[model samples]
Target: MTENWLNQIKELKQAVTHSGKFHADDVFSTALLRYINPDIHVERVNEVPEEFDGLAFDIGRGEFDHHQEEKVYRESKTPYAAFGLLWRVLGAELIGEEEAEKFDHRFVEPLDYNDNFGDDYVIARIISNFNPTWDSNENSTDAFWKAVDWAEMILRAEFEQIFSRIRAKEEVLEAAEKAEDQIMILERSMPWKKHVKDLDLLYVIFPSNRGGYCAQAVPMEDGYQELKMPFLKEWCGKSGEELQELSGIPTLNFVHSSGFLSAAGTLEDALEACKRSKELGTLNEGKQPVLLNVSHGISSEWSKEQIKAAHAYGEIIDFMLPKIEGDISQESVENFIDDTVAKILATKASVVYCDGETYLTYGIVRKLKKKRVTVLGACHNLNHEFVEFVELK
Candidate 1:
């Protein structure tokens, strides 16, 4: 808020805000203002003294307070608490327009939501805990300042990490510019996942700390397990000479069973292996694997941990996971078998995974075994699940 009061507050380097049982809004507002100008004086009171001409927020129903009838909300529909209000006016300007949006989404929004609506967030809980206990003799005002100091520390650490990620993104882009072909070789590994998917890369060959080099297939899209191109089906899950004989790369080392990644003896070996995979390898296109979900009567999306476990075997995808309202019949369930098999044939899915009505899951698995697919059962909890793909003709 570029109000006359705000202009004066910047020059005065002092602010006045409400003081009672404090919330994250006021605490972080003070912390952020102190971060900007450490010497700024902050006075808390039951009422913002009328004689006080300096900036007042989180009180007086001024620009930063959220208690007014007409509330302020961001474009995303999240209402602004005092901290969010101040962040939009000041913190965004301090960092940058782009970085500001990302920071607001990841950090600021949760606290704002917690304060405006009733919710439990660890950061908000930590600040609220600083309030003097009902039986404790400790002063509340002094405790407030201590919480502000800690909030400033938390903000500084988080911002520094974001700055480092910014620098890493720049370095990865510079390397991308120098790449000659689909295989982009990095002298050393930096975070390249965010930058590689949209580019024309099929494999990113980088130095592996474990040995010589590693080649990772670029995902077809972000946040999906599908790769643009995967290793040859014959080469997956093999080590040493076996992988060498299959891949026709004498120096080849190993390829993950999922075919999304591989480790090779040398940089040259990585480059050559990827070259051969492109020329001969065809999976998702020729025989690429997928972790198919057949949610016949079950209704649940896989969690990140579940997706991670399934990804070790192949790309995770949903097939015939329909949302059914009425009861199912034997005829309707039986009819799904032919339609499901037809969909699988349309794609070159090698590895299959299923979770659904128990009888249908087993029946589909038996039918898939007759096709060119490897059907496997899941055995574990969400915390730990495993799928060992034993090839079935």
Candidate 2:
């Protein structure tokens, strides 16, 4: 029985539409038929003439219509409207059985529901709105054809997106396989969570579309609201100079207030942040308050007098500074600050005072903030810079 129906669709070269008010069912069925065979001609008519040699739908006289006494329903009990009936057979042939099933669930099912139930659904309303208004002088046939055009475009785009995601799953799985104990680094981002949700990882770092990289915490389970590991609460809802000050990583971009995700100016910085977060979680395992500290520095840009003023505040922690050369990438600067801050935190000092170039000082301050450490900048050269000992919290 199914083979006969399939053969009929395969042999079909044209679509015959019933004359009357066009619902989403017949319009979409015609659209699907047209998609299957773009060369298929569509003709509108009040009756199926004996000479007409094409599929007749929604006219109470064919296998595709539901107005007959014997109504069609799927195994799950969803009634088969004209669109659903055609899609069940043709969708598999057009795309493939797997994709056709997916399309049925994601696209066709909703449409069938709206057509069989009522016009409450958005898709049904959109198709209905394409009809000529009560006061309008437009032809219904033209409107029906226009609606078919719209439906075809929508179906094509939706199927393309679905197939793209389907193809991305393998890449996501490969990255998940390469993950370390608690963190996975994807060279490029794709839809990954669904592939990696069952993996034993807490964080995933990947290149963002906006350039640079992002570190995001994975959810604890399939639908859990909580993360396996979240960004430090203190970094939440911070950005720009303030966030830089708090994080001490100069290239640090933003941490969402909910602490689920954060952005960094470099992939290295993003990975470092994820590693530091893991370490922070380990340190916090005992429920002890982490004793965070800061260190200060003087750039060659500072004068001797300014250096002396900076030294008066506190002892400077010795750390290697990144070379400030022409056209250095922000990522390189951030990496240097990230390393410096890690070194400072190792000392267990709570605060540091330093004077340096505006950019370097801000970078150090931001990195320190990531570890919840405080900083004080002194005697900086920039106008209205950290003049006196000011705390960067």
Candidate 3:
């Protein structure tokens, strides 16, 4: 049995409701209605008047109430609270049918479960927290309205993220089509990692924000629990001059401890590392690895003059000092350097170059060296100094 609530909602000048204590269902229902038609007003009431004119909900003896002997249940047998009921009738009209159904499953289903079954779901708890406490001096109606504002913001942000993922999918598909047999080289970085699971690729090479290219081994499956072909264990946990000497690839920068990823100074060197990895895989089987000539340069930083000079050497990862207004404490500077190192590590940068101002601080250089990440600093006019050459226990 369907109510003509859709058409009835349109004629109502304001949403008439019972107030005092509000539940998630009532708050969400009011929010959704207001979002659909911003001009509609909300008038709280204690009793259902005999000659009620506007749309009545929650406490009123109207079609929106679920407290009566008759109840509403979705196809899945979950009881529909006021929010679910309203969503079922009018959700598709606001959003498309497919998205509305998806939203109901992802967002509305849990709320309905908590409202009907007395479950302590997070969303229900969040809405309940907005209520005025017993000792508080705030008005109940004001508190209820505050929760409505938060609910609207949550809904809008979630919808935006969902649509963004949909658009990213198209870009991933196009890249997959043109990808090499065992590797995919993306010109720029994006949220493409999630969309490449089913493709028959082993490695993904892309330009890192830290400068040079990064060669990341694609996991055998989702969650990256394991890789299709990991970098050779011989170079694991090694970086800087040592990594370059061991690999005999002058441009090699770092190899993670797990051997799942490695970095190179240039695209050519990154691809060479990939080739070496495949060779090791084949040598273990008494076979030869397939070789491919793939090289390209990408950089979000570096001026045209700088690129021309440094392109041959690959990407240069540098950290420069920020301008400070007044005297700075050593503790604060150390904390800042720690945070900067953390951000660079998150990108799995192989080597990081520091400006003379930052390098003058011996402790900061020591901290970067401890991470096993290659650190280069300008010491004097003649040449650049390598922190890797400094011995630290």
Candidate 4:
């Protein structure tokens, strides 16, 4: 490695040394590992660095309530994870036992057929070559990644604590009270970047109770493809294969029969639906971005007073993108989505609403007008609310 690479590795080592404590803020190490192996399975083990695979099988300890032990363990058996553990071991070997132990508690008790080992034992086993049976299975990548993520969480917690201390000191220190005043000054003025890379883990780790699932297909190669179904085959298409083959092509029955989009549920469900749709590669692949279609949620049964109340909220005056946090009202979600449609269309987007008014949200109209994304108001119609979708040449 070059000087810069060596420096980075050194820093990485320092970060990993303080990886034991469970903290929510230390996302950097996890981010680095993800950066290193974007979509692979690898647990961040801090042991030998060269000889053995760190992950040993442990079916006896059973499952834990918070952690998805079984699922994670399954991932730990993948080939990618094995390779990652080996990589760590190789690196550890080069650094030697004494130096490696200084950074982490992985020097002794490398690997065994037990789960009672501490975190250090886990790391050591990862980098040592103690067993061939352990290497027989090929699923270490997931566990390795989990380790990386865990370490990062610890690091972030430590950093936050440090920041809290600095802030506490600054209260009475003023400008010249301390020798490191200049450093403090720089720290205070520095542009801080938000670390939200692990937002996915947030959703995954703490999933909401309420959710709805659907699947659709997008054109790839010659035909179509589908993935991720949460509904029974009866409610969906003819069979799993048929559902998987469902497409969002112009001719197909694109309308969703179920009222998942407008149903009473947690925001978690809504977000999950959108994300699942994106993952399935059915729509919104940076090209032909389709409006997530939903119509059933628009209830005529709602009293006029309720509807008016939802409309009168100041923050939601014209059209607003509802922030997905806290107690989100149903009206807020509906209007926000409607507004998003108008906004996109106002920018020249060709939006096609499934069965709801596409112009009710003025914010959407404004944004759409600016972007020039063509808008298509396909399904339902509402009174009075209008956003200019076309501009005459």
| Winner by lDDT | 1
What ranking emerges by lDDT with the best candidate at the front? 1, 2, 3, 4
Better of 3 and 4 by lDDT: 3
**lDDT of prediction 2:** 0.71
lDDT of 2 by residue, 1-393 (tens): 346455566567766768868878888888777766677787888887788767777774677777777888765566778888777767776667888886786577667777776837788888989999999999999899999999889877887887788777878777778888678888787777766667888888988899989999886543223467788878889987888788778788898886778999997788877777777753222121222223234344353345345433233344445457788788988887777777776776644544454677677877766654555555321123344444555
**C-alpha lDDT of residue 242 in model 1:** 80
Arranged by TM-score with the best first, the candidates are 1, 2, 3, 4
* Candidate 2 vs. true structure, TM-score: 0.60
C-alpha RMSD between model 1 and the true structure: 10.3
Clash count (model 1, backbone only): 5
Worst 10 residues of 3 by lDDT: 286-295
Scored against the true structure, residue 70 in model 1 reaches a CA lDDT of 84
Q: What Cα-based lDDT does every candidate model obtain? A: 0.74, 0.71, 0.68, 0.30
Q: lDDT per residue, candidate 3, 131-196, as tens digits?
A: 889999999999988988888777768767766766667776787788765777777766776788
lDDT of 1: 0.74
- Write the residue-wise lDDT of candidate 1 on 1-393 in tens digits: 365433444666568888778888899988887777777899998887878776777888888788898899876677988888888876555676788877887689889988987688899999999999999888889999899989999988988887777787787788888876678888887778877767877888898989899998887644345678888778888998888877678788899887888898888889888888888876344233556655554325554246446445456666655553579888888887667777875766655656543666666777876553556544431123343322322
| Backbone Cα, N, C clashes tallied per candidate | 5, 12, 0, 59
Candidate 3: where are CA atoms >4 Å away? 1-18, 32-65, 68-77, 86-106, 133-138, 279-393
Task: Tell me the tens digit of each residue's lDDT in model 4 across 291-368.
Answer: 322243432433223323422211111222333667777788667766666553454323322233333433443454
Which residue pairs overlap in candidate 3's backbone? none
